[model samples]
Target: MTTEKLFKVNGVELWAETFGDAADPAVLLIHGASASMLWWETAFCAKLAARGRYVIRYDQRDTGRSTTYPVGEPPYAMSDLAADAIGLLDALGVERAHVVAQSMSGGTGLHLGVDHASRVASLTFVSTTTGDDELPPPSDDFPRFSTPDFGDSAAVEEYVVRAIEAESAGVFDEAAARVLVRSDIARATNFEASLTNHYAMKFDGPQGGGFGELTMPVLVVHGSRDPVFPLAHGQALRDAVPGGKLVVIEGAGHGIPEPLWEPFLAALVEQTDAR
Candidate 1:
């Protein structure tokens, strides 16, 4: 079924989609930079809902329909982003949740699970990293995306829309892709900028050390075909986190494609429900 839902965090009107029973054990789904809830495969979210788990996927501040950060307010850090996640959980009165994050959001989720274990029941790290040194440079075949010169807002949106529309799923059609990509970049600029500052502040500060503190079960999932963040990052996350299991998808890419949804969700649901 179609879903439209909203919540308030730090007095900001945060938007999200609710799937599954609200009363059931909750799974808080976080997206990567430049992504709203649009990145998730619909079938996967619905399947988790069907299995009696409350799947809450939200628009991080500055993305989707959520409220944007104020102009003069302090820029957001990785901690700030993690705080936003916690704020959402607190706002909903959710004591603990299964946290699933992909790409850049993986770092933020790692911060949360290690620092605030009370809030994370389990962690699913997908196409993600814990800021490890084991990450190799991107391969020659992969398109280098998100450089400092991504061009102006409109240009970046146009490029991203055109690029993602060409993906196999046909999910983000031309028109829909434009709206989602354009709006996401425009709204989330400040928060994303803040994230950049955070990156600079802690560049080489430490790598995934907090994983040693994470006691909860974690499932690290990645795609062999993913060009952006290769399978090595996944392996590193699994290694850093104690007892973490790595599940590699054969044909999957940077984004979780529909072809791998079954295995991804099965692995995700299994780990989330197991412990």
Candidate 2:
């Protein structure tokens, strides 16, 4: 079962949902840029909860039912996003949590692990790159996606479906993607803002030290066929953090598709369980 609520953090309202027992170990799921908690499907959260984890998935600022900024003028920086996570934990009465982040939010996780190390138990980064200039650029085959007409719900849903097909290696589910996108558009506070504002935010590096300063257990999850960051990025990310581990999803692209959920879950549970 999932419990949804609103919390006042950093003078803005954030909508969030939680699964399983509050007394269990907590896992905070941060979605990629231009995404809401909907990307972290309910079934996935339920499975994690069944493994004795308290799962939390939320709408970041300008996404889902949370507060929204104007379409092209987001007022907060990326570090503010990291601070919002800490404020959320305080509101939930959780002293420490396992942090799981994907794409752009991976930097946010690094910030928490370095600057706010006391609040995080472990860090799991998915399909993201470390800000290393030496990393190879995105593959030439990377998807060239189109923007949606936000006023037309059908058009927006179709856009999402096309994006999923392009991003996944061979596990795109059109029906499921349509269903999820429809709900996402219908419930979002300002769907257009959610999709556009995140891209404009500036990222300030960790306030303390860098990834090498992280003392918590770090796990990197990447797809074998990821076009954006590629497997090499994941390898380098793991190498940067002390004692970091990498889990590559064979035949997967940038995101964790449904078929690969079990393996990803196993890896996540194992990482979070580490001392």
Candidate 3:
């Protein structure tokens, strides 16, 4: 079964959707910056849920149908986002959950594994870095598209499609991406706000608290060809945490492409199951 609801978390309403049985082990899916729960496509969540896991995906403060902040002004900090995660879990009566975080949310997951270790069963960080200053910068070849006019829906959709194309390795599906882009724009209270506010969001302190602070199982999934954070970042993360594992998606880029779902899902399942 599937369910959707609005949760009052951290004094803000966050929109959440869940798939599979409530009785099953819960796996929380946190998308990257400026993205909504739609990024974790319904089909992907369903497939993960089919593996005897309850999957939960939600929109952060300034994304999707959830609460949005004024353009270029987000009041919350990175730590506040972590608190929001805990509040969401409390509201759901979930004592513990396996967290699958992508890109920006990876730092959030790391914080949870450190400050709120009791609440996180396991952590899976995808396409993210360890925040180690020594790491290499993003790939020079990785393309970036310019933002489109917010008032023009077609322009916005085209921008999203082009961005995804540049981010994917070689298996990008323009049709599927367009569908998601349309939904994202249509449901957002202010799509432009997310784009602007995320950059403005504050950080309570340095992200990725001491690696020694983490005691739970940790998994780092990165594409071999990751444009941002590069494969070295993933390797460093796995090496930092005790018993942390790494899974490299061959020929993949910044995000999880459709073709690499099998290995990605398997690695995720293995990490959670190990716990």
Leading candidate by TM-score: 2
User: How close is every model to the real structure, measured as TM-score?
Assistant: 0.80, 0.97, 0.96
Which of candidates 2 and 3 is the stronger one according to TM-score? Answer: 2
Give the count of colliding residue pairs in each prediction. Answer: 0, 0, 0
- Sort by lDDT, top down from the best: 2, 3, 1
Q: Residues 77-175, candidate 3, lDDT per residue (tens digit)?
A: 888888888898888889999999899888788778888888999988899987899999988887767778988989989988888887886668999
Ranking by TM-score: 2, 3, 1
Candidate 1: where are CA atoms >4 Å away? 1-3, 69-74, 145-157, 162-209
State which candidate, 1 or 3, has the greater TM-score: 3
TM-score of 3: 0.96
Report the Cα RMSD per candidate: 4.3, 1.2, 1.5
Off by over 4 Å in 2: none
Clashing pairs in 3: none
- Superposed by TM-score, candidate 1 places the C-alpha of residue 32 at a distance from the truth, in angstroms, of 0.5
lDDT of 2 at 201: 84
TM-score for predicted model 2 compared with the true structure = 0.97
